[model samples]
Target: MSAHVPQICVMGVSAAGKSTVGIALAETLAVPFVDADSLHLESNRTKMAAGTPLTDDDRWPWLDAVGAEYAQAGASGLVMACSALKRVYRDRIRAAAPGVVFVHLGGPRELLLERATARTDHFMPSSLLDSQLDTLEPLGDDELGVAVTVDRTPAMLVSEIIERLRA
Candidate 1:
């Protein structure tokens, strides 16, 4: 495991504000924030844009790459936005980047879908909401992570994380 105690993963369903909040969290922590979506291949982007939900295999490499970055981060921890919907997906990332911590941002399906619907130019379409939900695992008490509700202001969420990390 890496020695960094608080390397954070701002994870959630699409449109759940992973990218938006990850950037803020990273800035607050004085670390680099990465948008994992930028790492997506054009093919995957095309597939999702066409209303297709990606299988686990489609996401494996991307997760691996993100994990690699985490491992190489050394003391300068990073925050990243990734829809780590399943336990397996999270496991793979943690496996590569030991000591990685996740901040699971979750919200009501209706709220998420509404945001997705309002978005433009994003690769993911609102139609895949159901598929995303099918794979989502709410962070459990024993999950070795923080589960924060995304139903509040970003500042509130960031404050929650900042306090958690400090504690």
Candidate 2:
């Protein structure tokens, strides 16, 4: 693995506040912030906008792009928001950027649904929340990261993640 401890990925299902917390966390760490959703291929975006969940085939290329972005950032490090909802997805990214750490932002399905429903401009429709939740695979015990509940304020969550990383 590379020695890029702070090349962090803020991961979660939709409405888990990956963007909000990821941007804040990047600012806190004084690193560049990238939203993986922005890296999505137009085709994937179209599928998502059309109320269709993407297959792994649709995601592989996008995940590769995301991984490349992280690897390209190099030792300066970066904070990125990605819906790395499965272990395989995280593994794919780790394959590209060996030392990327993942911060799994986890919460109840109801909360996620509420948050997704409240959003208007995002390409991911609220209806996909169930599929996202169903697909989520919690961080394994050996994963190089921490899992924080999103029930608290972003500041609190950021503080907790910082403390964990320091350990």
Cα lDDT of model 2 by residue, 59-162, tens digit: 99999998999889989989999999999999999999988899999888889889999999898999999998899999998889889999999999999989
> Which candidate comes out best when scored by TM-score?
2
TM-score for each of the candidates: 0.92, 0.96
Stretches of candidate 1 exceeding 4 Å from the true structure: 1-5
RMSD of 2: 1.8
Name the weakest run of 10 consecutive residues (lDDT summed) in model 1: 1-10
Cα error of candidate 1 at position 107, Å: 0.9
